[model samples]
Target: MSSNSTPYYFVPGLSRHPVMASIGLLGFGSGMTGLVNGYSWGAPLTIASVVYVLFVLYKWFGDAISESNSGQNSINVDVSYRWSMSWFIFSEIMFFAAFFSALFYARSISMPWLGDIESKLLWPTFTAVWPNDGPAGLVEQFSTMGPWPIPTINTLLLLSSGVTVTWAHHAIRENNQKHAVWGLAATVFLGAIFLGFQVYEYIHAYRDLNLKLTSGVYGSTFFMLTGFHGFHVFLGALMLAVVLRRAIRGDFTADNHFAFEGASWYWHFVDVVWLGLYVVIYWM
Candidate 1:
């Protein structure tokens, strides 16, 4: 085993996976502690910490890329990488599923039973309602996000981005490198704009509609489902950006384009999830 040409193409010496995971876990723990304790600066500090950590991660992965492209990732290493990525994506699916399940349980079980006309002796004031307004009843008697304005716009943006990614995929398969790069760039830009509008919508909800996270069960579930979906959208956009960067360098060809395909697949997944949210959370 006369190895030493590249750092990651072959097995490097013992690595620091544990230390890195611990750093992330510690940051999360402290942030959550402050949040639960009602510290004023908790949210801002947590966000800053995450941005710093992301910067560290970018530089670290860049170094690994330098090694792998230099012939470090051999056949065996590639196999392991594929398996790791598969499991990681599977884990993400489970994460999103939990939120969806929460939504289903709330709408189907809790609201119906609580509002049942039969429950006169129970929750007399409660009525089996589609939009429960707020659990604590703090919100100023409002309507849902609705399918017309912000939500519909976001849905179109996500759906169009999905189509663009598919176009980019086909272009790569046909060796139309320029189209692939430009299509991916457009998809990434749309995702960022969608995120921007979503943030603006949140501000409107908080200030104008009196719809904060603490409003009640309605607010809680609404934000939990949509907020998590928004975070996924942000992540998918970043993935597309990475794919576009590689495309610009002429790195992917038809048959050897799993990297781009994987990102595209994830973006499509996000779009599908958003469609569900738009219908359930917004319209009905």
Candidate 2:
């Protein structure tokens, strides 16, 4: 493509990024499987695969940035990108929905059925209850996590991040680079602090509360929901940081900043998920 002429529909030449990303994902999947099944090489392989994946993403995104900066991305391409991001967020919604459904089934339907008059013959001592320890000493006794200082604080942090990210979006749209940078920086900082508090909460769960993955269905569900959400938060924060870098370099204009908008979409999604988790997992 020439610098003076813009294509009607921009399509770059074939690249190896797709295959490279696939290879990284394959390695990551294999490493995770090995780690779960107790292989000595699993840890190193997982770490290496993560680094490789990050490297691939850095290069892939760099290429896209260059293309955008070169005016290769047309309005059609922007629309396509927006549609892709919307679908991706929808997929994420379904992912969380499945977990939420499982929690509901376990708590409302299955628990009540098991504790009813019919199943008492099979397990006489069993009681259908929230945060159960399972039948016949199958699960370890552990205290439940409640809506307390740590969870409440994390909720406040994420809520604050949502506001800051919105502020950044508005700032970017108004071409206020300074406010945009500060807003993004604050969002990232809040996300980091939220993750830190989550780590402390996990430690407290293990060391003081005796709450672990082996504690019961409750423990597994709690960790799976919150852990995956935390991972999303990490990804969102990373995206914001990248956008922040771009903002500092004056890469975004009043009308041309899908990257910032996309990152904000994801950050808001993360914030919403945490709110659900706070209500269902902690308060309920």
Candidate 3:
């Protein structure tokens, strides 16, 4: 094939990766269901399935990387990848929307209805508050987390990481490998620090504040939002680390760096979601 000429679309041959991935996911799902139902080997099975899934992804994507590096990927292939990634992100947005909607319904509708005039006639002492001790005192009288020190610090860390990732992207565009590497390293470090603070915050919530996943509506929403977001942060950090590895190996150039760009997009999406969490979950 010519180095720079119009060419036929690239079509990858069928492989066993997809079947292996599906099997891994099935095992993971089965394990999760078993764990929820109190099976003895659930957790270990889940871990194993997770490891298998990761292995499959590494192998599958490694092939794609090899194809791209070999100049086998055409313009159509690049566009297809972009479209696929965009749709994937859109799906994620919808996932979070469902959770946020649940939070709204609980706080705005369910709580109010529970404490309404008719409800008071039935319960006699229930009060309608945003973060009350929940109906029948089922939830403990615990304090909610505020957007202070730890959360604020985490916010800063994520924001700074966003900036650093952007710097890395810019550096890559300019073909400044040294600056790009440093920027990616900084982003990874900041993401790790953010995760560390999150763990400490969770400990504080459980031990000091008496807040937990089972602590009623407030606790449930709190954990669901922040916990899922933390998981995303972890995934995003992992994606960045992979990109960094590729960069160190001189895989990206000014013209072909969608791997870096895709990871950056996911990281920025993560940052924005955290900002929303800070405002709605912590500050409000």
Instruction: Give the per-residue lDDT digits (tens) of candidate 1, residues 197-221.
Output: 8998898888787776666667777
Model 2 collision count: 0
lDDT preference between candidates 1 and 3, better one: 3
Ten residues in sequence with the least summed lDDT for candidate 1: 1-10
Per-candidate TM-scores read 0.85, 0.95, 0.94
Candidate 1 C-alpha error for residue 262, in Å: 2.5
Rank by lDDT (best first): 2, 3, 1
How would you encode candidate 3's per-residue C-alpha lDDT over 62-128 as one tens digit per residue? 9988888888887778888888889988998998999999999998999999988888887898889
Candidate 1 versus the native: TM-score?
0.85
Give the winner by lDDT: 1 or 2: 2
What is the C-alpha local distance difference test score of candidate 1?
0.76
Which runs of model 3 end up more than 4 angstroms from their true locations?
1-6, 36-39
Clashing pairs in 3: none
